[model samples]
Target: MSHTSTMISEDIEAYLKEHEQKDLLRFITCGSVDDGKSTLIGRLLHDSKMIYEDQLAAITQASKTSGTTGDAVDLALLVDGLQSEREQGITIDVAYRFFSTDKRKFIIADTPGHEQYTRNMATGASTASLAVLLIDARYGVQTQTRRHSFIADLLGIQHLVVAINKMDLVDYSQERYDEIVAEYQVIADKLGARDIRFVPLSALKGDNVVNRSEAMDWYEGPAMLELLETVEITHDQNRRDLRLPVQYVNRPNLDFRGYCGTLAAGVMSPGQRVRALPSGKVSTVARLVTWDGDLEVAYPGQAITVTLEDEIDISRGDWLVAEDDEVPLANGFEADIVWMHETALEPDKLYDLKLATRDVAGKVKAIDYQVDVNTLEQRHADHLDLNAIARCQLELTAPVPVDDYRTSPGTGSFIIIDRLTNITVGAGMIHRPLDSELPYEFREHDSKANVVWNRASVTQAMREHLKGHSGKCVWFTGLSGSGKSSLANALEVELNRRGYHTMLLDGDNIRHGLCKDLGMGEADRAENIRRVGEVARLFAEAGIIVITAFISPFRADRDAARELFNDGDFIEVHVDTPLDICEQRDPKGLYHKAREGKIRDFTGINSPYEVPKAAEVTVNTEFMNQQEVINLLLKAL
Candidate 1:
């Protein structure tokens, strides 16, 4: 092996030995552009003698081409290694760097400062125990600075270090440092930052960075390195509450089945009794096994495979908790979400919400408000756009275990994924479960003989009778004025007349009531289809045929809606009408409005429409009248 690889292996071994003796501290650095976050970390590593000779040589060569004259080695170059980041002089993705002092080993998450990469910052801060927020001594606290601080607080980062960086630029004036510290004091108080410390330093000049600077003799504060080494980080973890979220069940042989996962919180010892959530099965810990051998105990941050004395049916996405502490279970919850990706968050749609290892299919019940990061004010919103932070309520199809972020950060956070594309679109922190106090409702129903059949139940039966038909949804999708809505209405009429219970869910009609509060946006459009899918499922359960007509232009979104149904239950009927023919029809004057730019995000006018590749039925409106389209659909049924 190469010398560097050998050294890295030795370092990892030493780290493992040290970690067994004491707790580990993980922290993150966050602030605005040019706030010296990267410089501060580089200074910490350089002064600690963590930089190798080759690394130093590379930095020196890079400095000659990229560094400002007479500057202290352009320390930010040490961590910003990406080609794009180096050329743009900005941090992008979360860069993880590890180093150790005699007192404690440290893992630092150096996060980006750009406004567009707020999601990256949140991702890094989510696992951080402490947050070091840098502020420019000359510029004071800018909007991005406050915004990063707020996000750190929202993610449950308790300890905060306010580094008044670039002191040399501001002439090392104690008054200027004091002014910035005072401004942050108000913010720290509002964010509930438990332990807030202020220190004056110049990351670029290395003043009060790793050592005390003679230039700032007037300021009496611990040096950055000294503070990091001495800070009490043991209390930053949730060790008191035992939570082990099972990521996988390892069944290597027929006789043995072990639950494998990283300890999210607390400690687990061999022979300790634990309870699995939702299932409520109690078992005693039989053994804690690592790759090397068996361990007597395991704690948070340690990944291990655990065996139970009883042969219970354990699987991934299950949680193991202390028997005395109540297991988290709720069908509805309130969460603070940071919207990521280009798509907006729709209030009326269903999304795949993943918390720890568990995936819960949920719908957005309501969007309470969105926060203005610059002002820290909450503004009521119907939908949240990209890069927005909002408080919202969600209702899941089934109960999932969760804790309030203030109580347990690991068990309280989640991410939302697009069902069809599986792209992570949002991150969320649980504020509270909405139904914690109510009794658990079982899926039991009264006898059907005494009750009047609902539209949902009738549709559900029809879906089952058709086998592939009973649980699937028939989505009538096409351009507006292409006879989509008319064909759906006629199909429902024919089915009802033939003694089959049927319901026609028109997109515009539902929006007039059930989805009345939503609007038109990429995010809203996806969400609208999600809500309609759920309602159609309810109808299908009742043994009736449910037909839906909507101008769902995106193929990915339509597929996402189709996934909610069982096989053969989802039917995509494409009304193939040319744009010119649609305009000629101009049934509602929508085509004229779209042509004149009076409407935004119009499918054929402003936005690109995706044709379905595997549509179940394609009706040519130009060749066939409304009756012919209805007859084609009826024959298929």
Candidate 2:
């Protein structure tokens, strides 16, 4: 029966509008094995008149063969729909059911209670606002109870209801219910669970599930349904930080281009300034469009299409956030992982890590410790086994925006997929970002040495204001004779003429002074590039437009240089003159000597030069003149 069956017959549209206005609460029921989680849900549905007659009759018939209760209707058969579940009288997989009362609608996840399916329970609890932790009155509290409680707390389920079921077995004993509540409260205190409420019920006999049980008159609290309907979950959402991860670009015609996604947090309105991540483009929200019409304001969880005032580059998997929000962009972080695969976690193996809509390859760099769910003890382990929970450090191929899982679960949680099989093998909650590129020797020195970094009283903003321009890094990378040096020098001269504070770091000039001791071998060349990159970064920090011309061959070394600056500050200009042109223009005769094996490991001759994959500007010096190249670099800048 519908909650508004009379209104549905009288005014169908009005009924729908009323139904849509009602808030939804998602909760999960979980505990130890055979703790009557399914039974409790079935009782809630039956006693509240949420179940239909046909479904009730079907379960009444199923009660004859598979019912655990003797000669009584088996309500547990309502949610235990699987044949294996009915036969074994246990929930193996997560089962969801939807029902509503006059006050609020609910979607309940009846998660499995067995130790083997703890991962299933975690999956169900990931999005729930409340958790109904069922404990058998006879057993008090079990190991699985603590494990589930800890996981629920870790997943940020702040509301908890410790439902002590099978109270009739204890003859409605208030002492037993009190004892169980006292025992579970200790664990709850350890977990720091908030808004905990205790309810005594007999799932089989329907005591205090929906209707207050007359047998337990000593209990003065409201029923389970009452507490669920009135719990304050409105403030649970993160309403301060605005995030909308772009899921699709809705471009129906030339005039229409709207970024479509659900608001993950906070509120949005017209004229609100937002920034596109990974690009750092800022634009104001022009309009908020939904399927029905344009909205005046949008809140979290509303699926809407947003139009920006400026035409900037935004694509799927990019994030739109408030311009001032301090979202972290990290390539490595520490996370708590729940390993779900049978194969143990291998630290060196690469796996597909997915957070929100963004997917990238990453590795579990190290396991900090494995948590014993029973005792909440941290034990050191190299790898994680099946259903093992541990804190591990992860390294990703590229940096993406991240948040702490405790404060923002929507953007902070991630999953690990097997590389070959593509099966989701583990789930993780991010703790914090780790320093990504620190070498072991440097880390040891930092720990042992007493060197401290001194802070300058003058800020970078003040320096930029004094210089009348923002600092930048124009990095030119290509073959030795590919006109990189010529382009860098010309661009620096043009910028200097324009009254911009500029510093030019040329490859040959640096070798004569700063890197005179470095050789031409691979390791020495890498160290040489690292030194130049650091000097360029320092110059850029001093509010100077730093220009660099180097045959930085390795992509990894170049990426390290790029990481030293903020996004959009590092501009890589690839001088794409062909290798033949570069060799022909070899003014120093180095290419000719390398052809005769005089200069060994020379770039583009014996050594390799990895071309820039995503350069901001690519100019062919063979076709374009020095003035044209300088103009192009200035335009990009």
Candidate 3:
């Protein structure tokens, strides 16, 4: 190592202490085929004096027979250790190397530059904070180069170093270098990386690899090693939200019990209250135990066992977070999936999903779209093949705490394993959770029944054009007596007076006819809304404005209803009348009967009413009259 000093021979403990204090950086090298990824890494190690003489001698001997370079010792042989890799002269797997300078320690992931091994590249980029994208000076840019760059950005690599290698072949032409930089700048702009630096270097000739190049006088930027040594990476960790996914429960004896995990993000200390996910159990940290000793404070990436003041139920696959943090409990989410298996992804087939330390069974419910990496276009795809990338909706068997990948990657990324084969088939980064879990009846049945959606020749657009207006679903939801029915009635009448077609589906009227068999239980209410939503969808398809008024108590049912319509077609109106006012204005005398213990599961009395979190329009009947609510609804429409 370049940091080797006389203290190593005189005082070993002092040397070890000094070496442990240096900052560590993890980075990856990726690009198109034969782009000098391995050569650049070997050159860095060779020039930095980090290689041993015996290993160097072995490579020198091997270079005479297997080296790509003629006569000269091939530096790329350092990382290409596999027999297949040496014989083929191409990287087939991820190669790792370690080196250090005076300022910082570094670990380099030398990734393959082939389209077939895109999954290997993704594996390397997942843990990398920076990417060294090598573009051959002669080729400007290539398809694999764009693909690797997109994957690097997608994996949340904040810093990018665009290494324009083999400048010697291009005669160190500043014009050629500038052109490649310009082309890559467009990609960097699309990535929106926090930091991007470009350097023109010849990895074989050692030009600008460790020292300034006399051949490329026009390029005045720092050399590749200097940039690596000085680049800022301390801000990359997510320190605002504490996350510790329990990997193991240490119970060696009856007197000791600790939760073992590497702190994924944020800070933790003794006495800090922690909440266990999926159980909502809270406890305070009593100790941060490690093999050496106890730590006063625990930072991200530290491996330690945490003992709690209160013994609550905690096991593997549960997350311990700060009590006040708001990580979402998700049973369904949308993610960008990189499929790596030969068998095409079966949307209905279940797979083992491992996120952090949590493992659960899940399945892909839908494939929203697949990406064309070269042009970055989204195309509709029904199934994903090997090395395919797509955005998919996944349904989990149980809820788990999750964060967006941009927020905390440790808890936001996951892998899909084949249940029978026990092989990893896919990787995913969560974009966001779905609004709520679909009711069991709303999900696809597992009976293997033959079903298909039939298409019609008469399109909705044709019907809408004939009516001179677009169809819409104006859904009104609130407590029973909160004027949802009255407002829905007024809006339909006004729309009809203006010569627009309208249909009103009132709750009482529907129960008397369409939902007469259903009761007021939770399951029956959800089914009732599901039936109404389908009928309203049919009316809207006929070019008639559909209006609905119901005390849709569950947010999940409301969200499911909204999913049936296209964007901007479903407008949710929340009636924000107070409970006191609703009880006083109870038109059906249901609130009075509920207070006298005569009614069961009456909303706003015995049953809970979940307020909408992001309703489109909100009206308060206590403050606003029916006409005002109707006018607002019309304006929104």
Off by over 4 Å in 2: 2-5, 436-637
Which lDDT values do the candidates have, in the order given?
0.84, 0.89, 0.91
Worst 10 residues of 1 by lDDT: 453-462
What's the C-alpha lDDT at position 544 in model 3?
A: 88
How would you encode candidate 2's per-residue C-alpha lDDT over 154-242 as one tens digit per residue?
88999999999999999999999989988988887787566899999998888898889999999999999999999999999998998
Colliding pairs, model 2? none
Considering lDDT, which of the candidate structures 1 and 3 is the better prediction for this target? 3
Quote the RMSD, in angstroms, for model 2: 20.6
Query: Please, what is the TM-score per model?
Result: 0.66, 0.69, 0.70
lDDT of 1 at 196: 86
1-637 in candidate 1: lDDT tens per residue? Answer: 1012343466888755765565467899999988888888888888778888898889888877776534448778888888787788889988988887657778899999998888889999988889999999999989988899899999988889999998999889999988998887778778877888999998887899888999999988899888887888767778988999999998889988899999989989999999998799999999999998999988787899999999887788999999888766889889999998898889758899898899989978777768998788976676788778998888899998879888887889899999989999999999999777543333444555544433221223334554333434679898888888888888878877777777889989999988887788888888888788889877777666789999988898899888767788788999989988998999999879988889888888887788999999999889998887878887777
Query: Cα lDDT for residue 13, model 2?
Result: 97
The local lDDT score (0 to 100) that residue 71 gets in candidate 1 is 47
